[model samples]
Every structure is written in structure tokens, then in C-alpha cells.
Target: MSETTALSSLKIEEVPQKLQIKNYFDLKKYPFEHEALFKREKVTSVIGILNEIEPYAKDWLKNKITSAQKSAYKPEASVISEGSYNVILENGAVFKPAAIIGFSGSKDTHTIYIRKGASVIGANIYLNQGDIYVGEGTVIEPGTAIKGPVILGKNNEIRQGAYFRGNIIIGNNCVIKGELKNVLMMNDCQFPHTCYVGDSVLGYCTHFGNQATSANFGIMGGIISKTITLKIDDKNYDLNRNKIGIIMGDYAQVGCNAVSDPGTFLLPYTIVYSLVRIPKGIYGPNVILKNKSFEKGITEVASLKI
Candidate 1:
């Protein structure tokens, strides 16, 4: 497809500056072609095409407000008792130790007290001194380290030897394994391998292939910053979190060994094929590669027009 043809089909009035970063990535080095396409196609039609490949995009956005609310809600201090410990940082902030840990095996006997509705395989599962809250129906494989103040939702499978850190919130039906450092995940996500997921928030149903990782700092070990602007209720807003890794929308798949640079924001349903390096941007649903002419791939399946 010619650039002009692709541009004529998309219907965007103007490409937001934040969404224009796709030009910097190797896969999408052509900006003028993408911008022109944006003018031709309507956003709804484009979203429809992406939805076919990633059905969970709309669901993820729909639940954002609820997730935000849950994050904002604070548990009462009075509700915490002696068996439940609190870790107070030097900044004077307090965190409940139990909410952050998950244990399995004979370790349960060592637990001073298990919180209400906390699940375990049996008394055979041991729990260290960390504060851990095992959500209803959550399962911890043998030999998993249950850190303090870890809040896990229902039906999570924490694999063996998985090391968890505090300030982590895992939503329902997620699978985690192999050295999950401080991270927060929404519902239905999976990190099922030896991947290092540290200081990140994963949207619902987002899947990470084996060894897919994201960097949080620059070469000098200094913090990296990137600006992200999203349209909310037709108004654009900026999320100013410096330590951000990647804000992937629902049903977005990160291929194996793919390394997303720090602060990468992938729109809903975008798929990164294996070994592909995506520069920052709002990548349209599909892309076509032809004889040095890169164009938007057809949204419809089996549309022989391309």
C-alpha cells in the first residue's frame, strides 16, 4: 500500500505529539505516512480493527476507574492487630506487612496469625515473618518466598522459588514466577517465566512472553523520564510518573526477548511480534512491510486488498 492510500483511509484530525513518538522506533520510522493516514481514518474504525486482534482493550479501559479507586482506598489502621506487622519507612509512611507476602508449605506453622480468608495448601506450608495476605483462592507453590504487605487477589498461581517484594498488588487470575520484584498487576495478567518485573503496573489480561523485559533506568543508573498523554473523556491528560516502565493496554502481547525501553506506553491491543524493537508511539493495529515502503496493514482479516 502506498503511504497516501494508507493516510487517506485513517481519520485522525491531528496526531498528538505524544503519539508521534512511534517515528523514533525502528519499526515505524516514517512519520509523514502515518500522520497522513491518521487524517483519513476515524478513531472508532481504527479501534474496531485493533479490537479484532485484541478483544480485551475495551474491558481494560472500562475497569481503569475501578482500579484507580481500589488503589486509593486505604485500610484502617485500627483493623490491623498485633499478629499483623507494619513496616514504617523513614519517610514516616506505614505499610502492612501481611498484605505483601504469600507463603506455601510447612511455613504456615510459623505464621503468628493468618489473616481472614487467607488460603493455603495446608499447615504443611510454611510462612516467614513477613506480612502476607493470601487472597481467597490464591495458590502458592512450595518454596515460594512470601514477603510482607503483598496484596494478592483471587486465583493467582505463584510458582515455586518466586521471590516477591513489598508494595505489590496482584489482581485476580494472574500467574507469576521467577523473581518478581516490586510490581503491581491488574486482573488476568501473566508473567509466567524467569522474567524480572520490577516497579511496574501491568494492565488487565496483558501477556508477557518468556524473557520479555523493560528497563527502568538509563545507562548511568539514573532515573529515566518520559511523558505520556492519553485522551480521557475527550480531554487529554498527562500522567507524570517518573519511574514508569511500560503502560500497556489490555490484550497487548510483548513477544519473547523483547525489551521495551523505560516509560513506553503502548495503546490497547497493540501486539509486538517476537524479537521486535518498538520505539515509543501509539502504533496502529496492523502494519504492512513492502519493498522499503511501510504502510498500515489491513485491519480486516482475509481482506486480499493489500
Candidate 2:
């Protein structure tokens, strides 16, 4: 087989208009209505948008929590309030409010909004100096521990042993069973089984199979930290941020045990096969990436001199 066939299986379906966030993501089908927060005209680049929206997104999330806290319309479900902690339950969703702890020891209030048809049974919610919003029909199973300052959209299944750090925004119908922090996940994305995703943006219908990881940091720290750069079509673009993960586009897939290096970016419909280590760069839309060693005829029996 040819070398090109062993590496990338499919050709690009369509080229993007620009290297902007809008070109990669399907904003029309994005579950969250926070496009204004992206400041599209101000920061068109994908990494630029993420850097520009970090503080704004946190503020927006806090505002949402505050608004929900002051809501006058009583839900038909159970609401338990004690001191600065409030747990709102709907559709028989059950969890011990005491398990939700104020880990930061701050004076700020903590609110958990579990909407209708959602459940958080036996899950531990850590009020890590922020609030949590669980949308309708989401299920957070036992052994899952979630740190607050998150907005989870409708119908997500957060399975057992899943761990979530703060500052995350998730869209509808996702299957999350991983360790996540500071990320935005769009509609229908899946990270089923143990995985690690941090400081990233996952687009619509993306999937990360079991044990898939996005390495977000440089190996060597201090004054001489490695800069994250993305090379696409012979052009090198440096992302100024110190830490970055993957900026996966819509319909992308990372196979089981696959790992993406820092500053990796996948265009729409890109599929990375299992056990592959994707380098720090920009990849394609409608393409299949695989290791050459995985080819069927590559293995040959040879005697070792040792």
C-alpha cells in the first residue's frame, strides 16, 4: 500500500472559508445560545475565540446561576435549601445535599439546578466556589464527582466514575464518562469510559472512545516552556496560550486509547484510529488518520541477534 493510504484514508470533503471558530463548528445546531460570548468579529481564530471567551463564559455562567437562584417560579419538584447551599430537584431526581460541599470555604452561595427528568443519584457535587446547572433529562450516575461552575445541557448521560473539574459547558445528548476541565462540548458528543479532556472545544457529534486523552500542557515548565503551535497547509500559527488541548470540529472521532498532543486541531468529520498519537497540528475534514504499523501485511517474523 502507498504511504498516503496508510496515513490518511479519505480526502477533504470541503475546505473551510477561514481558520475561524464558525467555520469549524456548526453553530446553528450548537445547543447553547452563547454565540455572542464568542465575540466572533473581534476574535475570529479558534484559539483566539477560546482565549477571548474564557472570562466572559465564566461571568455568563455565574449570571445564569444567579438568575436561577432568584427565580420566583417554583418547580413542581423538590427544592432543599440550607444556608448558602441550594439543591433543586425535579422528576424524582435524588441526591444528598450534604454531599455537595463548599470546598473553597468562600462566602459565596452555591446552587445546584437539577431540571425536570434529570437525576443525580449518589453523585458527589463539589461546590468549588461556583454553581452548577444540570439541564432536563440528564443523568449523573453513582460515583461521579462534579466540581461546580458548569452548565450541562439536556439529556446527557454522565456515567459512573466520571470526574468533572470546574468551568465546563456541555450541550445536549452527550455521553460523558471522563475527566474533564475547562472545556465546551457541543451537541451529541461522547467520551464514554475513562478519558481526559481539558481546555478544549468539542464540536457537534464528536466521539472519543475509551481511554482517549487530550494532553493539555507542556512537559517542561518554567521560563522556557514550549509554545503550542498549529501547522496547517504549510502555514505555522502559534497559539499564545500556555495550555491548550484539542479543538475538535463537528463529527470528529478519536478512537480508543488514542491521544492528541497539545494544540491539536481536527476539522469536521476527521476520524483518528485507535492507539494513534496525533501530533500538535491541524488535521482535515472527512479524513481517516491511522498508523502505518497497523497495516495487515506489515508484520513479519524475524530472528533477533540477541
Q: How far is candidate 2 from the true structure (C-alpha RMSD, Å)?
A: 8.9
**lDDT digits (tens) for residues 132-198 of candidate 1:** 4455566676556555435566678887667775545667788987555456566788888766665
TM-score of 1: 0.50
Which regions of candidate 2 are displaced past 4 Å?
Answer: 1-18, 29-32, 40-42, 52-54, 69-84, 90-93, 103-106, 233-235, 294-306
After TM-score superposition, what is the CA distance of residue 116 in candidate 2 from its true location, in Å?
1.7
**Superposition-based RMSD of candidate 1 using all C-alpha atoms, in angstroms:** 14.7
Query: For candidate 2, lDDT tens digit of each residue in 1-306?
Result: 212111112222222244567668877765456566566444546665556445655677667666653433232233322234656655545554325665445586677777778888767777656778888889899888888778888899999998988878888999999999888888888888899999898888899998999999876646677656555455454556778888899988899998888888888888888888888777777777777785752212222221
* Ten contiguous residues minimizing lDDT sum, candidate 1: 46-55
lDDT of each model, Cα atoms only?
A: 0.46, 0.73
Error of 1 at 175 (Å): 0.8
What local lDDT does model 1 show for residue 97? 29
